[model samples]
Target: MNSDAAISCPPDVLDGSRALRLACETLDIEADALRAMSQRLDGAFSAVVQRILQLSGRVVVMGMGKSGHVGRKVAATLASTGTPAFFVHPAEASHGDLGMVTAGDLVLALSNSGETDELTGVLPAIKRQGIPLVAMTGGLQSTLAKHADWVLDTRVEREACPLNLAPTASTTAQLAMGDALAVALLDARGFGAEDFARSHPGGALGRRLLTHVRDVMRSGKDLPRVQPEASCVDLMREMSAKGLGCSAIVDAAGTLQGIFTDGDLRRCVEAGVDLRARSAADVMHPRPRTIAADMLAVAAARLMEEYGITSVLVVDAQQHLQGVVHIRDLMRAKVI
Candidate 1:
């Protein structure tokens, strides 16, 4: 046969209806697996959570092949949700990485067959070290399950793959079980958004909850402020010098009397008022939108959006002008 003829074949004809039907079938299979797993959860799941809570060390997850991929994601989910955990490839564990596991640490081994050679090879060592093992596998009577202190049955009736040879539904069941464990542990530990934020300082939730107005606000010399009796020229100069687009009108005692922004200046100009003759207090908007310095930066962003303004003054309990936060500051900090 000619090499080109042997390698070439007609493109498979597209069948939109069949494709959609297969996709729906796959989802239905996986959804059914999850529902069955949820129904099968018993005291064993809760015992695992309770044991992990009392553990002083972290959860070390191990697996091979497709199970390894799922294990990595499960480890990440657990770590981010306030459970301390990490993934260790089972093959690597046999190659001296088992030293990473300590007495207090718990092992969460994943293998669809529960007899993966690389994973099972380390069981004896883990047992000798007296480290508790929790097997997440479809194999109930396999070596991994036999050696485990607790067995989480992640078995599925069938794969979502058309040939029923792939790890689709089984891996989904394992991942869902991992998430269930993390959520249960999170609730038992009373882990809240703040705790989750600390673990994900680079994420959106962290930026919103951990970042405060004081952390992003302009203070001291950077804050634009003019005394109540200062001329409008002085106020404009202060605003321009600080580049905050607004100036706070403060009294002699550093109390925030009012705020003057570019809008206020535009109104003054449109009214044909002599800015040079006016004091900061005369052109300022009193009782301006203010936020406490301790408030979350996202809250400051919300105030700016709600009032259709670009800047807000940060004040203390006694209404003393502490700082100024511009919309740009919130954007730069990614709080918006």
Candidate 2:
């Protein structure tokens, strides 16, 4: 829908598509504001980055209302990305959280108007602590900007809201800018995906990066295995007993020769084979999916999916059998 149709539509009522288009327009305005901020990033931005780099303590982000919410998210992102940071409500900081701030910590104050009474109220205390302050705001003359050791200019011409009252484009700009800052600091600090995973230990990326196949793969008495010279009937029994739906076929020396799965069993049954007489090698896939025991669980899961299999055999460089990984294991462990 076009802007004219959107405007003519009722205040409280409009078609879903028109509303979605308006929302997209608001996002576009914010995206443009972020672009403007990026273009303005020069030596001043570098100076702010240097100051943050020198901090020995956490980045205490503080703000009110929407800015406070944005500050919380920014702090979380910074923490997970290698910068030690946390959000402290300026009002609450006045009460007791101010103690969390020490002389070594740096402050990132967020205020759209740059004159929030609650945030401004803490300036004296922040000053007394001798902690450096970095201001994110629209007004250069605001109390926050005036006192900031490093001020990041977030000024915007106007908001995307038609009423010019809601914080639409401004908040979006703040979020995008905050992300840029965190990412820059991340790069400067040499924070990699593994470092991020360490910070977000319970999140999916953490599980993927830190979890190994050995942590999730079936081993020892739980592993399913059969010999190449063994009968298919007995191997099927092993698969059923282990509940792995598959069994690795090893040579006399315990080297992986092949893999026998339910799919292989189906093919054997269709081929009219005498299950009791057929050897494991006769029905097994000679080159089955295999991975290293020390490989990441996520990589093992990907190999299984790419091959459309339910289990992967763990082996050494010489194909010595070690263990087995079941698709269900990855699912249960939440590695997939």
Candidate 3:
């Protein structure tokens, strides 16, 4: 009614509470959409897995607009999880990229409306290559769906957008479906951590899976070693010098006999055992946990956690001392 009243508060301008409420509402819509889609995962879903698993070549994924973006992610997830998938833009596929699709490959095309011109334009070529088509679409009767060998109906009730015009809920549903397909294929292939790490060698997961105890352990001079007959003071000196919180008690032949940790030192002190008079073998833990040098560093971490200890002795098959692997070494390597 007046300039001051008009300036007081704009009806379209959301406050903090309204903003959070709107955000939550969007998430709720997507969550419900995913739930509905999850229920539809039945025989048809299994059929897609069957086709994918039977293939000898990679899966070529194509889509348009927002679907194209989600398709890229789906392709990456599929590839990284051992399915060997890659994205080809539908428009580009109409060019020379269509050659990338071979007879052995399967085409996974995404189109919410199922009639996207860019997508349908390349469908004939895919069929020409004798590539089985798997369509993820809302319209089951649309051209892409009608022509596809298998249809994954990713139909959502509505979009999360207030205007119901954006591809919010539909895209989220598509991504979830892609993840489901990837995980399912991974399981069917018996794809383990080693397979995944091979695909992602530059990441922390790769380090955890590929790095062995010998790769991270302190060997030779860096290792804190002492003869079984060495004095407790000498053991403590080796522990402090190496800063590994423990010393490996080895025999004259360099065979690991025991380990003397700071914890053992404390107990010896509490028991009134003279540190200068006692030998490392007299106070050391005779049955300390040891891991082979060939074991995974993550496995070493697990062994330490299982024993409630800070470090473990690295040994060979003959109980020969190889090195010391400390929890801090694992943390530094980002393998923990």
Candidate 4:
């Protein structure tokens, strides 16, 4: 007989079995804790946000072990969302990193027991600097809470671990609460795309937030342009030189009157038009979709998507051709 057939399901996999029993235990404990957290929300959470907002200096987040990991993320979220903040290891603060926290700064400390020795070790120095302490802890009576300027009680019934040792649900709750606080502050500060762009000017979100059509649009040597009076043969030369497969046909005053693309050229050839003698204005599509130079690349994307066009002319309010933005360029940059 095969071992796979011979072996039965583990005791944990059956009804009212080990896994079922433990899952019940975990759910009961965590569910109650989560529910309690909802009821526990009061003035303290507000006070923390208020204090951080009022502070003239940065917010220093500190913790140890798993809490330390959560603290780093909390600090990052806060910093990127308009509030200036950074994480500091509690142990390092006991050494020399304490210098990072200034008298005007606000400190948000994380510890499940509310009595992390490393954190408590630097409390005296923080007190000396007169820095405000906002403690996140499960134990209200813990030393850290007692010494805190504001205490957020995150009391939990038990750990999700079978041995009731490892932090699972507690840390999840802490991270969730931290995110809530950061987003709330972000909203309150009137934080918009531009404010977010400054914090994250290197990624796709940054590009979406900061990049404008003029910044990425093809111009000067790369611009596909021809005079309206130019022959189709001459317009093709401009297209070939720029490799844009299209050229803007501008009037004597430099106002965009039409666009001549490869598609238009193909149609003209199919119609047996005399390409050598026909001027650009006679052959080009009139009134092509145009975008303003100051418009966001994202807005350009919206206009392109709505019009189902591959290219848009970047022009000023006065309709002077500033440059051209192509769908291929936006795609290559992953701006769409």
The most accurate candidate by TM-score is: 1
The best-first sequence of candidates by TM-score reads: 1, 4, 3, 2
| Cα RMSD (angstroms) for every candidate in the order listed | 2.3, 4.7, 3.5, 4.6
TM-score for all models, in order of appearance: 0.93, 0.87, 0.87, 0.88
Q: Per-residue lDDT for 53 in model 3?
A: 94
lDDT value, residue 276 of candidate 4? 83
Candidate 2 segments exceeding 4 Å error: 1-25, 251-253, 281-283
Candidate 1 lands at a TM-score of 0.93
Off by over 4 Å in 1: 1-12, 269-276
Which lDDT values do the candidates have, in the order given?
A: 0.93, 0.87, 0.91, 0.87
Top candidate on lDDT is 1
- Give the alpha carbon lDDT tens digit for every residue of 1-336 in model 4: 778866754554456686688888787778777787879889988988888788899989999999999999999999999999999999988889998888788999999998889998999889888889998888789989988999887777778888879987688667877887898899889999888888889878988878888777998878888888898889988999988789998887878899999988889889998888789889999979998988889888998899877889988888988899998878776787
Deviation (Å) of 31 in candidate 3: 3.1
Identify the runs in model 3 with alpha carbons over 4 angstroms from their true place: 1-13, 267-272, 306-308
Encode model 1's per-residue lDDT on 208-290: one tens digit a residue.
Answer: 99999999999999989989899877888898999878899889999999999989888888999998888988889998999
